[model samples]
Target: GAGVSQSPSNKVTEKGKDVELRCDPISGHTALYWYRQSLGQGLEFLIYFQGNSAPDKSGLPSDRFSAERTGGSVSTLTIQRTQQEDSAVYLCASSLAMVTDTQYFGPGTRLTVL
Candidate 1:
């Protein structure tokens, strides 16, 4: 089956602009996650969605960042008022379950906010 995939492989936008990054997780997988890797920094957890349960958004960096998983499948991460610091590789991953499960990662969407 297909693995996790993110859209727009690369995005360039002016500061303060809004950008929407998409992710599609593998079928039958009930766990999805979003992460960001900034230059010279470790991967940062952004959010997680499991089945129909409430999403864990504690990892979101700021109110400017938000996401939603629909039909327990596709997900969209929306960043409002993008900032220069937001430039990074946004990664998506999926697993059969959480925590102990093995996660499959996407190629990631590279976002550049100028």
Candidate 2:
């Protein structure tokens, strides 16, 4: 199967606007994750989904950030009321399971909030 795919590879928006980033994980992958990376920084975990269990969203920076996965395959990350500090790349990754598996990442969605 194909690797994860994300839509709107690049986005530029004004402060306080909303943006939706979509991701399509590889088939049969039960674990999915969302991460954010700022300039010259490491990947910051945002949210994670595994199988039918409750998603671990502890990494979300604020209440305005949220994500959901459908059928354990496609996922979407939504950022409400974007801010300048939110300018960074949003990455999506997936694996067969949560532990002892390699996560394959997609080409990140570069978001620039002005």
Best by lDDT: 1
lDDT of 1 at 75: 96
State the lDDT at 4 in candidate 2.
90
lDDT of 2 by residue, 1-114 (tens): 578999899999999999999999999999999999999999999999999999999999999999988877899999999999999999999999988899999999999999
Task: Score candidate 1 by lDDT.
Answer: 0.96
Evaluate model 2: give its lDDT: 0.94
RMSD in Å for model 1:
0.7
Error of 2 at 36 (Å): 0.7
Predicted structure 2, TM vs. truth: 0.97
